[model samples]
Target: MLGALNMGAFFALVYVAAQLLRTSVAATIMAVSPVAMMLIAWPLLAERPKPLPLAGAGLGLVGVVLLVASGSGGVNPLGVAASAAAMGLSAFGHVLTKRWGATAHVLSVTSWQLVAGGLVLLVAAVLVEGAPPRVGLPAVLGFGYVSVVATALAFSVWFTGLRHLDAGTVGLLGLLNPVTGVLLGTAVAGEVLTGRQLVGLALVLAGVLLGQPALTRRWAARRAARVAEVSPGSADHPGSSTVDSRVPVE
Candidate 1:
């Protein structure tokens, strides 16, 4: 079920989104996934995002819109709806993983989910797309990279994140996926990165950083320490007050 929703449905709807909408528009709509994940997590995981992170998620959305709009592409209403559906399905899958796999080992959970999704994709490919025309060296290497590094290792970390962090926080990190994708396209796929894309990337980074609890805590602690040092109120010590709010207590 997790695979069906997250892997299978996610990919399937992506195809649907592509067919219904322009590629850029599809990507833009899919970019709303973090917000979708947040909404899904609210009831599924009983998770509520902080105010700043919520705003950050909204900012990320704005970035995605800019990124897509900056590109030259046609748009469609149905495509927008399809992309939204894909985003919702993706978010739903993430929430389910966090909820149902709460106690499961990350490797085990990710493995099973990927297997299920792979099986479904395999069946779909055989039925609809037919056999591969050719498995050339580049195609084989690409497949291996996506299957191993992208799916196995990457999703392992993602599943681990779902286990440890609130869904909203982890979901916000997903915005980085597009940043990586866009940068990769520019670096390897011969795609151009427009000013809008750069702005979008910046917004996404700012949003994701804001959504990090550990980072926020450290900032707060540092701010408190600065205040203590400047205010001259030695609440914990004779000369100065030390407030350690960093995660891991390091």
Candidate 2:
């Protein structure tokens, strides 16, 4: 139920923004979805977080800021509003995905949401745009790629993974999107990544990677304890340490 509304809102907003905002601005604004998810999770879910996730959230925000500042173009009030709506709703959807990760059937849940969203988008296209404009071959191909590869194949793997993972873990995987976007922009679209953009990207990557509990700080703790136990002090003492390094420090 929640996924339907959230995913539906995202498709609608993305469609509206593509029409309303410059491509650069639209691209940048899209980065907000992940950050918004983390923020929403902080408030709504009973999930614990680590430094990296927090950092990723901060970096994601920086990316948005840079993207906004890079454009001196007059702000379209509609675009801004639509973008905000998209992120906020997306956050809610992610939280729900996480909440139902173990129990719900990811494929079924996603399928139903896509069906509902597709209908809404179809209706919206008809009402506002009066049918899609005559798309060129390039645009047609692009749409085909989006629908076939991005939507169908991508989500198939995504939802399957969701069924076996926590929300944060799933969210962390999404960090790849922005980085991939930047790379694709550079290679395919000939857009350059500026110094600020690079920094922002680094920060965003760091945050997302750091955010997951799976990549917990326990590693360093375990290593340190192992070193301590094996040090001359412990080895000099009889029966000082029998615990495996994997065990948490009491």
Candidate 3:
């Protein structure tokens, strides 16, 4: 089921949607996945959403909307449906993996999931597309890169993150996908970054920072220290204070 949702259905649907929709439209739609994952993780994993992180996610989502809105193409209902389904399935699968695979080795789990999904996709491909088409060296190289770096290595680290972090935080980190894509386009393809995109980029970075566990822990620690200073005593014994009885007698 994990394999089907994350690897097979998610990838298949994304490919279909990408073919039908403009790049910006498809990417913007995909950017909402962190929110979806947060919602799914709430009920499934009992990871209650934190207000600051949730707000950050929302801010990042709005930033993504602004970032991609400039280049959005005409909407196709089928394409929209496929993109939404891809997002939903991936989010669901991610939460499920976190809940069920808590004790499993990350790489082992990833390997099995990929293998299972690959087999299912292979069978489907044979039936639907008849046979694999011959590819040139560049195409083969691209496939190798995606298979090794993108699928295998990427998923290994992703599962490791799921093990160590709250699902919401991990999901929020996914916002980097679109951010990286836009930056890469600008740097590699010579695409110009507009002012709105620049603002959006800042927001996305801020959101990701807000959702980090280290930042949250620091914020919590500071708040706790301030409360301690204000109260100056334990809640159970409000006015009581501790003193060293071993001091020299006055």
Give the best candidate by lDDT.
3
Query: Against the true structure, candidate 2 has what lDDT?
Result: 0.68
For candidate 3, give the lDDT of residue 197: 92
Q: After superposition, how far is residue 74 of candidate 3 from its true place, in Å?
A: 2.7
lDDT of 1 at 232: 49
lDDT of 3 by residue, 127-244 (tens): 9999898999999999999999999999999989999999889888888888888899999999999999989998988888888988888887888887876675754345757555
- Models sorted by lDDT, best on top: 3, 1, 2
Worst lDDT run of 10 residues, candidate 3, spans: 235-244
Candidate with top TM-score is: 3
Mark the regions of model 1 whose C-alpha exceeds 4 Å error after superposition: 71-74, 185-194, 215-250
Which structure is stronger by TM-score: 1 or 2? 1
Worst 10 residues of 1 by lDDT: 241-250
> For model 3, what is the C-alpha lDDT against the true structure?
0.87
TM-score of candidate 2 relative to the true fold: 0.70
Residue 49, model 3: Cα distance from true site in angstroms: 0.1
Q: Give lDDT tens digits, candidate 1, residues 1-250.
A: 8898888877887787778776667766777777788887888777765676788789887776766665465677777776787788778888898888988888999999899998998899899988869788999999999889987999899989888888888888877767787888899989998887889889988888888988767877888888776674665555655564663554
- What lDDT, from 0 to 1, does candidate 1 have? 0.81
